[model samples]
Target: MKNKLKEIFYAGLIILVALTLGLAPVTQKEIFSLKWKNLGLQLVEAGVIDQEKFENLYTARGGLSESDKEMLYGRNNRDFKITPENSGMALHMLWAFGLANKNPILEDGPMMDPRYGGAENFASTGGWTLAKGSTMDHYSMHSFVTLTDDEQALVEKVSKGIFRPCCKNSTFFPDCNHGMAMLGLLELMASQGATEDEMNQKAQEVNSLWFPQVEKKSAGCAA
Candidate 1:
């Protein structure tokens, strides 16, 4: 009878552990089966990407970028469709939604998703919240719309001259370029309770400090 009880208790514990693993953040079940391409289609439904823009972005680099796109797009299709499972896909999806209608989707999405390293900051049990908020869409648009063609050519010229030995390419995220740093600073400032007025003042400073050549980078980027 004692041995039988021990066996039953052990079986229960195993079941509990199995359930926990299945529900883990990046488990095989969570990470795989993410409908990334379908999520892209959802962005289309949300009108985040118009047909022209969608085609442009979809065929922009032709399966050659250093980023995960090449690996992600197999002949079958996006085998990994991230749900609320992983932070990376969550961020991208929220970005798509935020980009739509110029809404503060990140706040409603990622900032509320309990992922993408947000627990240490906004929406956590106790972090920070300021009047100045950031949207991932804004960050993306800031880079996209700004930097006119000439400026892009110029920046590309500069980028080529300055070899980022650390950055394996534009996609190697570890490389601390000006753009990434700007986003980080923006997040920090927003969480620090800085007002838009205060942000305007500091925005000028940050643009000069970070993106020296990109004048008025915040023109329509900030909300």
Candidate 2:
């Protein structure tokens, strides 16, 4: 009976994960109604992206909703959604967020692993081309988001649970850009009061956007 129950539980868990990925169109539709204005200002203050540079880059891209403009300038709250059209930008934005957000994970965590030579040498830190200076200038040095002790603990816990397809390690060991970006997303969600379950759900959604092909295949098997 115990073995049977274990199998049943595993089956349910697989189905849930599969369905979540299978319904990507629906699950990925989640929109984050966070204060993106603050995030933008944080990015600028941290030198993650210069204001002039951001304007030039956005304009060159050629599509800006009035809402997008507000996210850049106004203090209004903003809604963010991940789609194929904008996933790359979202990754960059999240990368900046992860870099600037004040968290112990980046400072004393696996990012400091001696095997990587130094934190700044990794893709998460080194690959950031949009920064005004060396990416190390902002690496976990800015107080972009102030989390309470509880929130910090929550972010740390959730980050360990998330993994990106590009790396075998979890976000806690963010050696690559995707892992770091996911760490930033997890921090933002925790600071904004996302519960553990909500954080996990959002992580999966972001991961799906980042790796749709992989998500589709895994989702197909149990769906």
Candidate 3:
């Protein structure tokens, strides 16, 4: 009876560990739908990317509208597709979103704290070079998306839970480049009315894209 009880306990422990570590089957199915057309236009309008740069960037990858030339002009499908080639572009757009979006989290969050030796010193603030002037010129100063009180709260709550592999800090802190980019993505999702669950799902997808080796190692651990 003692041996049997020990086996049962160990089995339960293994199952618990697997679940906690997200060892379940990963899927290729589209997890969430995002309106890229609107987001793209907004990014452009916010000076995240201009028409020439947008065209140049996307065209270099094989034209903005891969199929159905109509997508080139007006709104395309609501489903946001992720691919290896576009992953870097997505990061850039999200970085822009983080920089331009207006929210109290950027103003009052840990990024504003003095311990980081000033916000401009960090990657999120200093790493951005595509903009017209210094990245500080646009750091959390633009009004791309206006979030309501509740929406702002949602961003804050979601940001606290999301962590980046690049650093130990959560998006709320956003000291590094990846954390700041994630913060921007979270803010965009919240302002666009993404549910908490959806935000988490999208975050996982984005992070996986950003760090392929990390995802691979994680999967290997489960195996």
Which candidate has the highest lDDT of all? 2
**Across residues 1-223, which tens digit of lDDT does each residue of candidate 1 receive?**
9999999999999888978888534534332232233434434443443445434543664622323332223333444433332333233333333232221322343334555464224221121111123323232332212333443333333222222222322211212333233233233333344444553444344334333344444322221
lDDT of 3 at 168: 62
**CA lDDT scores, all candidates in order:** 0.35, 0.74, 0.69
Q: How far is candidate 1 from the true structure (C-alpha RMSD, Å)?
A: 18.8
Error (Å) of candidate 1 at residue 185 is 21
Q: Which parts of model 2 have CA positions greater than 4 angstroms off?
A: 1-28, 55-67, 216-223
Looking at candidate 3, what is the lDDT of residue 206? 75
TM-score of candidate 1 to 2 decimals: 0.22
lDDT for model 2, on a 0 to 1 scale?
A: 0.74
Kindly report which residue pairs in candidate 1 clash with one another: 34-80, 34-81, 34-82, 35-81, 36-81
**Tens digit of lDDT per residue, candidate 2, span 1-223?**
9999999999999889888888423544543445465676658766887777777777788855565555545555556666665677778778888877778998899888888799888888888777897878878888877889999899888777676666667888877888888888888778778899888777776677887766533211121
Estimate candidate 1's alpha-carbon lDDT, on a 0 to 1 scale: 0.35
C-alpha RMSD by candidate, in order: 18.8, 11.6, 10.6
- Model 2 scores worst on lDDT over the 10 consecutive residues at 214-223
Residue pairs in candidate 3 whose N, alpha carbon or C atoms collide under 3 angstroms:
none
Comparing candidate 1 with candidate 2, which one achieves the higher lDDT?
A: 2
